[model samples]
Target: MHKRVHYAFTVKRNQKNLHHQLATLPRAKASVKFSDRTDTHGRLETRVVQAPAVSDLGVDFPHATQVAKIIRHRTQRKNGKRSRETVYAITDLTSRQASPEHIAKIARSQWTIQNRLHFVRPTAFAEDASKVRTGHGPDNMAALRSFAVNQLRATGRTNIAAGLRAMSYEPFRRPLDLLCLT
Candidate 1:
């Protein structure tokens, strides 16, 4: 039997057509909504997520089951500074498979995924400074960087930068051993 995978993604301004489709949705009377608040490091943040089933909303994406708008309001407790932003997204999961609240959680968790994996590439590996700019060079370099990070993680290291530093101190052949090329 074949397995099916589901995913949710934010619609960026670059996706002009899809973004416009989701943008034109009625701002009033959403079919479902969820909100939550959290206090962290002198910041009080509240997030409201509104979603509607899109079977007839005419989203141009393939297999799009729902569309949502997430609004976040953040205020620094000490300074009383406030900021707000809104984001739009779509998901393949039907409303029956995932609630508006569940979709909100999935959307927020994407940041954690980015921070743990891709974010480290530039910070810890200096991927941004790489000179490989032609064709497959950049792609292959990215894959190698990801593999290095994953290898370090598989060795039970939580701090990737520190893991890299520790590995650098090892003999040159030690890192090669991790690649199983022997």
Candidate 2:
């Protein structure tokens, strides 16, 4: 089984304040401990009266004290029961001032098959109804399907399962040709 870690954080103006909050919070409490405890508590006291807001990328976060809530939820099964919990927190920090391009890449990378790809694979290719759960058979077949789907997409096939069908049923239109087979 694979581990699904859910990370939720916010962007804000006060970095030190955010760090302190992370230290005091539950899940992140142990993960992040302030090296300089003295300064962590006094961040609000030392703040400039009229500090300007921090703006990065296309968003402008206000200058006032902000609480960034970060929750990292890890789910696991124990004693034949699924256990779930969330850590609530407040902070004013962002891990990175991500570039617009970087944010887009992150968003794209978070895509899950259940939300987009899996249904198409099951509905279009009958992958779900597959009863082949033998040694290496299921794994190999899945790998081939994944490869075929990726190839089809790379070669401009709009629908994934259709590409699988074409690759599986048609010898002349095999992906190996587009795969650079001489």
Candidate 3:
């Protein structure tokens, strides 16, 4: 017997979409529940997740075993701006295999990694605005940026922008020290 594959996807907000239908389901029908709130990066965020068995909707999503709805509320400390968003998702894992809490954790972890690496690379390194599209220029630049990020992280510099600034004045010294080179 082959083990079935599992998948998770957000449902779009459309009148005829499955996500809309599932989102309208009663809260009492949810099989799993998870909620968390945290203050980080000058912002406070609250997340609530509900997962329900998708056996009844199996015909619509053959391999889906659970559907999840996540509501996020965020407030910026600096500006006091607040925003709320809702997301719907389907996963192939059953409620027994993956609880709402586990799924929420996974989602948050993925976002953290993405924000750390991908978001940083683009914003801090100005990668998206780079005109280095010829030959290996882009790849080489990416590698160099990755190396810089790793070096900064290894040297106990949590803020890449500040690390880059510090290294800019003494590029040779910092890289040499980071590489253990005299």
Best candidate according to TM-score: 1
The better candidate by TM-score, 2 or 3, is 3
Expressed as tens digits, the lDDT of each residue in 1-182 for candidate 1 is: 99999989987678788777788887674768999998987999898988888877777889998888888899999989999977787999988888879988998898887999999999998888999999999999999899999998898889999988887887576687666655
Per residue, candidate 3 scores C-alpha lDDT tens digits across 50-72 of 98887875437668778788999
TM-score of each: 0.90, 0.39, 0.61
Q: Which scores greater on TM-score, model 1 or model 3?
A: 1
Runs of candidate 2 with Cα error greater than 4 angstroms are 1-108, 112-116, 165-169
- lDDT-based ranking: 1, 3, 2
**Number of backbone clashes in candidate 2:** 2
lDDT of each: 0.86, 0.42, 0.81
Give RMSD to native, each candidate: 1.9, 16.7, 5.4
lDDT of each residue in 67-101, candidate 2, tens digit only? 22322222222323322322222213233433223
Off by over 4 Å in 3: 1-29, 39-44, 53-65, 75-81, 89-93, 134-140, 169-177, 180-182
- In model 3, residue pairs whose N, Cα or C atoms come closer than 3 Å (at least 3 residues apart or on different chains), thus clashing, are none
